[model samples]
Target: LLEDVKTVNIGNEMAVTLSAGIGMDGLSYAQNFEFARNAIDLALGRGGDQAVVKTSASITYYGGKSQQMEKNTRVKARVKAHALEEIITGKDDVIVMGHRIGDVDSFGACVGIYRITKALEHPCHIVLNDVTTSTKPLVELFQDNDHYEKDLILSSQEALDKVSDNTVVVVVDVNKPSITECPELLHKAKTVVVFDHHRSGTEVIENATLSYVEPYASSTCEMVSEILQYIGEHVKIHPEEANAMYAGIMIDTNNFMQKTGVRTFEAAAFLRRNGADMTVIRKLFRENANEYKAKADAVSQAEIYRGAYAISVCSGEGLPSPTILGAQAANELLNIRGVKASFICTEYQNQIFVSARSIDEVNVQVIMEKLGGGGPLNIAGCQMEDVTGTEAIAIIKKTLDTMIEEGDL
Candidate 1:
């Protein structure tokens, strides 16, 4: 099939290319489907325009050296949303969780899920703990709201203690098992569901009852908002919840400057109709003087490479939180005229945390994946133990140089 696609030539001498994944020797249909999915991902990762066949014990590949076609559609998202509704409705307890250092996108999606579970008349709990600095303001707002129930928020250990045979864990904003706030609770849960906008990582949660990973969506909250549209009109979303989701979309889209699509706007409009106040969201984004100064120092310390890549390290004291500071620094560096991609390295929690961003040309996802991290093409991150900020920057530079030389960036 790939060869036939390659053989077809238009009058102007343009040829088409296709990639195929063939699954055979499977004991069941579901097993075969899983094999095909993994095979296709592998084929695309090796650079598409190829055919990959995966059996129970062996794998074979042919012809891969072309760019993979990008799929942008909402049909699959709708289907997955319905499937997730079914999974949530059938379960007794729904526990929602996000990655470590929960951000706006993560917490917003959790609130969305909590609303959904409540609408379905199922008991739900949001597993949360310490948040990054940027999320602190939003979390405080939620806590202060009359409609928000602090009792519904559980710590990792608390959630673990309540896990039952019928409990279903819904992981949002991230699907990677290694990055979740509590992988142990996830393991103990009877079922798992994932909704994320990030690219799939190597350490994915296995056998999720429903997995919705949309790399094209601006944020997980955007995907959750779209799901809400399909979940029936009677479903109620509070003003606070709506605002949280809206704030999430705004943060991930960089205030509508990055990765904004038609669907992204549609979600925002829905939130606006639900009383997502922009004034409150602006207040949530307001940074204190010290945080602003820390961000400025990070920008001043940035090192530009090849006139396109900007790398910065937060070396000094007084930075409020390394994770939030690194992300802020990365965003700040992108404002530079010639920089196409930016990376902010910081020391946090005894690890070197690197937050990376791009203007969609550098494919930061692939770059971060090499270092055991993953996200979308424009934003990605990784954390490394036993490495100083300077050493981590050097490793990143070396990796970038190799990818650039190989024409992979």
Candidate 2:
């Protein structure tokens, strides 16, 4: 039904798509209607052009092959910024968090929110645990500094202890509760806000006071940069903060080469006016000798599966952050001709992390979703437990075969 819907055209120049929701086996009519509404929201949240079926037992998806359309207006950002300002002003305190094992985009977005809360003269703390190598340099700028509070960054337990009835928790870069830096804070706070660029999935942070999840935005940093412009006319961005946010936009967009649009450049220009320096960001992200070698090895040893998918394993021995290298390797594999998508697997913290990337031909997000993970169509990831790299590769291959047979690939 969805495939046929996708084939419909408008005036032979543009295609018309449909998003559907089906609910079954409900105990009451109202419950069934609620389920249907939720399913349709999920389908639209996942970038439309899909169908979601919800039952009391499970949720299923179908036909999400289309690319998400980017909005060309800044009206939504302006409205969200004003709403966020009101929420912060009403709260006694604010706590900001990103996904665990923080990256530039995640940490940068946190900093952006911190600025907002501080400008309102509301006490704010960023919850971060286990800072990886990629994020340490940026984090150090805020630690033990007179410009910011001494407890600017707190651990999960510390955040939990500090959260109060009047606190508003702002989750950035990631929307999934399970992967948040401190999921407990969500339950403790009276109000919660979410800002992310990833497509919505089955799992999400429920009952958010405000949500700004634009899959079309290049990165969460881009979205935050736009919000910063409208927060207040006097909200000044420090060079360090500008640099942090700029690094996020740079890294997530792969130096403005992927997932970038006109608004992305506009956001970067805004940061530049606030004293963002490209040279400083480049110096911060410079790779060490071992890190470079590990990434190259992963790329050199890559295996092209089915002549379209590039698969490789990044060895983590003696590496501070192997998953970062894995994601870099995945991006590098896209340069190979005839490769529709790339998947780089790395063993870290007793689990296998798979970072998937694609240019256009394949929807890597759908594949990752089937493996219990999700992101944008171009960049996605999943994690598996108790599986060897070779075993994970075989499993991925089987999934690809099944998806291909079902005409989903």
Candidate 3:
């Protein structure tokens, strides 16, 4: 169909071109339409002017060579925010959850969800797991606050046991079904609403009753913050919760220096007016001496490549958890002159973790996905089993080389 469409020239100066998406083997017509819609999005996301086909088992792409145009998203966000409120009001209970081993962005978004549900007078619980050192300070702050009801934070097992037909699970920050705090809970819940700012991966929660994912936002908190505005003027965010969301936008945007945009600052301003404390947010970012030293050590091991990229492998016996250090190290490497993309690979918890950060010119998510992980274009990470940090770095380098050769970098 695309070839036939392209064969015609509407005018001497204008040639006709078409992009098509095909979907098949779906159990229902709705599922088939969704697959076709996603396939077309993939075709356009990879730079349009092509045809893409989606099946139950595979996705095939062809003839994409043009650049994609940037879209205006504010209107779309408002529409989804309104739709989300309707879904929440209809549900009996709302359970909020983020990715496992949550980060500030994840926790911040979760807090935002909790606040939204509270305003709606719905029963809400935040499904939490063991957090990394990076989230400890803020988590402790929330735990100490009287307003942050401790019992509302439950374990994955507890959340799963509470799930019922009328329960709505709100997954934030991360959208991949497998990485959510409780994939089982997500599967068990009758209604699911997802709010995420990360690039959608292949293994996403396709069955969400309401899905609000905007990859261009600075963080999931940024997306949530915007949604908060549409919930109701009477709805309010406590200082602690506002602070958490602010910290989320700060960390994800590298303190408004990385992917910060108009909406990012708008959300930050709204939080500030609602009593978000900048001083507290600054305190939340302060790392202990030991963790700071570890981050510095990771940065010290960095090696620059491809003139604009940096890679660091932190390997030693009994080092601190690599999850936080790797992320901090990746962020730190970006501060170095001439580095547009940075990758930090470290071994922790019997697995190799890779954190990748980059400017818009480089889509680190694509690179991370190549290593069996996914995230936004600017930030991404993956965990590798049975691989040393050195081995992971080698694999990253090989992937980078391939991307360069294919003009994908």
Candidate 4:
């Protein structure tokens, strides 16, 4: 359980509840988790049972977690947002690129690129490597329809054959360049536009012409929805495209429950207004019996801790789609009562991928970041180098303990 309080921050070490209670300042649940971590270090060591909250009205607090005497020094750092915008008034040919295996969200973002390019009256091509099938129906729709033509959506070899430095690359849903489904296009393109909702890790395209990344948004679909809207009212979205984007939004937001925000609802409302059928979206996400069995087994293997749960670990068995199903499993486990934090660890292409989720009591992004992962406060994801599940689990536990001990749990 968690509580909230809105009060002035008075200077100095004052007693405050440290474990998990509303601080004198009204911090949101996510903020509370973050504050708990900060308070633990300050109040716990400074003769525990006192909190030192530093806010606008000056620092003050009351009762912190039981601990004792030490000096609480200030940590000052200036973090700035990188340059996010620039308009290239000229139009040119473009290519679409994404991660190793395209998922619904990334594919949906490609749809955004299509819309933007069409509005600009620029020629565009979407590169499809060996693994684009993971995105499913969208591929078939684009293939069967004559509207796609030979202009857009090419195979890996075809892309390499046609791509040139003049090509404007639009990377969707993913930021890491090292693991891109196609690296040739990224190397060949002179101008690039990246749109994604994932937390930034080490690998990102540094020279992108226009990059829009908002990890706080529910999905890349939501991000793309905004970009498409900005493009204007003329671009028509076919039924399949509309439904695919809707499906992407639905999948990323867990049917609009986990990471729903004002912008997310607005994006959904736009898709609904655009004639996207909810029934089609519902059908698109339906899985077979084997998938259901896997999800159920994954949940059964979950372990619970103090308001936190290591709900599922990725086993390579997800086969055709380890990340997608594994993400679903982790999101499902979050629905369990008392599970304040949810994690999904899966082995994807020999790399350990971890997705973390949190409610008010935990900051999943911070935890992921501490372990070379990154994301927003509520939902964040990361990939571990090449570690076994057992080693990864130990690292996770130690990180959780450190977070809890420092009051950030």
Instruction: Give the winner by TM-score.
Output: 2
Q: Which 10-residue span in candidate 2 carries the lowest summed lDDT?
A: 6-15
User: Taking the tens digit of each residue's C-alpha lDDT, what string does model 3 give over 263-284?
Assistant: 7888999999998998877877
Misplaced by over 4 Å in model 4 are 1-89, 130-134
lDDT: which candidate is best?
A: 2
TM-score of 3: 0.87
After TM-score superposition, the amount by which residue 46's alpha carbon in candidate 4 deviates from its true location, in angstroms, is 30
C-alpha RMSD for every candidate: 4.3, 1.2, 4.4, 11.1
The C-alpha local distance difference test score for the whole of candidate 4 amounts to 0.65
TM-score of each: 0.86, 0.98, 0.87, 0.74
- Misplaced by over 4 Å in model 2 are none
- lDDT for 383 (candidate 1): 87
Candidate 2 clashes between residue pairs 3 or more apart in a chain or in different chains: none
Estimate every model's Cα lDDT from 0 to 1. Answer: 0.82, 0.92, 0.80, 0.65
Better of 1 and 2 by TM-score: 2
